[model samples]
Target chain A: MSTLIDILLLSLMGITALAAVRMKSLFGAVMLTGIFSLLSALWFLILDAVDVSFTEAAVGAGISTVLMLGTLSLTKSEEKTSNHSQIIPLFVVFVTGGVLIYGTLDMPDFADPLAPIHTHVAPHYIEKSGAEIGVPNIVTSVLASYRGFDTLGEVTVIFTAGVGVLLLLGIGRRREDGDE
Target chain B: MTHHFILRVITKLLIPLILLFALYVQFHGDFGPGGGFQAGVIIAAALVLYALVFGLNTASAVIKEWVLLVLIPLGVLIYAGVGVASLLLGGNYLDYNVLAHDPVHGQHLGILLVELGVGMTVAAVLTTIFFAFAGRGHRDANGNLLPHSALSDEIRNRKDGQP
Candidate 1:
């Protein structure tokens, strides 16, 4: 039953992706991308990665949609057709996709017990986090305590991204002032 | 939006609920699926929604630009401060085990404080970005160029049923 739902959701995601790519209106494409993010979030939920699902829903669906809409207001709603040929781009995409698929061939089967990730420090986290951290959520314990430095780095990265956006958009400068 | 009675009423009712939910997700993250990142986005979304309908000036009145600017770095400092505190207490950087007499209690305290810092930084940063995007090329109530105006012509066009 779950597999069927996964298949359905995956197909829907593919359809949404194609629609977003083919859509002429940037607004519609943006909305389709939001739908795509929502479907991906659902897929994450199905995989029992609830934390990932929450981030996907909030960042991808919520924040990105609003930001894209803001961008659209500053630019044209309809994408302008370019005289440039698509053949080279299409060829490049196919090559990249093929290489990515080839790379994945060496990856372990999904959820394999012998996978490196499962064998790695995960066992210790699974067995010891509860007693050591006194937290029911192992994911939080691993993120905040076991790998706290990494979490700090991630937060710093987010802060940097925000600062970068503000810089590019001219946070303190008014548009009317024409100050670069 | 100011002219829309129904929207104004609905927004007034919904903003508090959204903010409350964000806080719930932030503090309850230890036992649940959400964390600082999710809570921050949700809280930023609530503020953005309010700004969208109530105008940027109103939102700014609620949360000033200086406050956001200060908060962005303050959160990171809080997170780093905890690590420094642990280090001074004879633990490695970010090692929460030595934060208190009992390692478990220290871990809990450290996690809670760190998450709060993350939440504060994320919320402030996102809100600042949204303000930067939405406030460009708009005027304030005083007819001055509002540094963080929430006016978007596309939004107005959509609201008016135009393409």
Candidate 2:
């Protein structure tokens, strides 16, 4: 059942990607990308990574869609036709994709108990997180407690991104202008 | 926008619920499929929807840019403050075991506080970015989009010209 769902979702995702790539309108491409994010989010849920899926849906599907639309509004909505050849880029992409797929062949089966991830700290986190952190969600325990520093860095990155955008593009002076 | 009456009405109704859900996700992260990051984005999304419906000016009035600027760093401060606090208590940096007599209880408290900090920062940062992007080139009273100024034309040309 899960495999069937996975196949369906993957097929839909491929279709969305192709459609997005072929799309001429930035608006259409952005919308397709949002659809792609939502589909991947659902796939993550099926894999039981609810936290990752939720973050993907919110950030990728929701916030990014808005941001991309804002970007589109600022620029031309249609792609400018380029006479440049795409052969080299396409060949490079194909080669990279082949290499990645070849590399993944050595990975252990899905949810393999003997996998390095399962044998190492994951079990310890699962076993001791309840008593140590007392959080019902083990992901939360690991994120906010065991891996708290990483999260701090992530927050700092977000802060830095906001500051960068503000520096590059100052906030709108529209409100004050209206009052005058 | 004014003509999109149904959209305006539906957005007005959904904004409160979206905000309430964000709060739920924020506090319930420890027990649910969400956390500070998701909740923060959700909250910003609510504001974004409002801006789309009522106009950017109305949304900016609702949340002053200065307020967002303060909020951005304040969240990181809260998160790091907790770490510093734990350090002051002599349990290493971010070692919440020293927060209370019961180590588990202390961890919970620490997690809640850090998550709050993360939520605040994420929400503020995202909203600020949106304001920056949307407000940089704004609309006139007729609701037509306008570039910031003659200077913005040069900026946009450079931006779009780049690969």
Cα-based lDDT at residue A27, candidate 1? 97
Worst 10 residues of 2 chain B by lDDT: B139-148
- TM, chain A, every candidate: 0.91, 0.91
lDDT on C-alpha atoms for all candidate structures = 0.87, 0.87
Candidate 1 chain B: minimum summed lDDT over ten consecutive residues — where? B140-149
Candidate 2 residues A37-147, lDDT tens each? 999999999989998998899888988999999998888789977888999999999999999999989999876879888888888998988888999999988999999
In model 2, which runs have C-alpha deviations exceeding 4 angstroms? Answer: A172-180, B139-163
Give the per-residue lDDT of model 2 (tens digit) for B21-59. Answer: 999999999998778888999999999889878877788
Q: What does candidate 1's lDDT look like per residue over A76-101, in tens digits? A: 89998889999999999999999999
Model-by-model DockQ, in order = 0.49, 0.46
Our tally of clashes for model 1 stands at 1
Per-model TM-score on C-alpha atoms: 0.90, 0.89
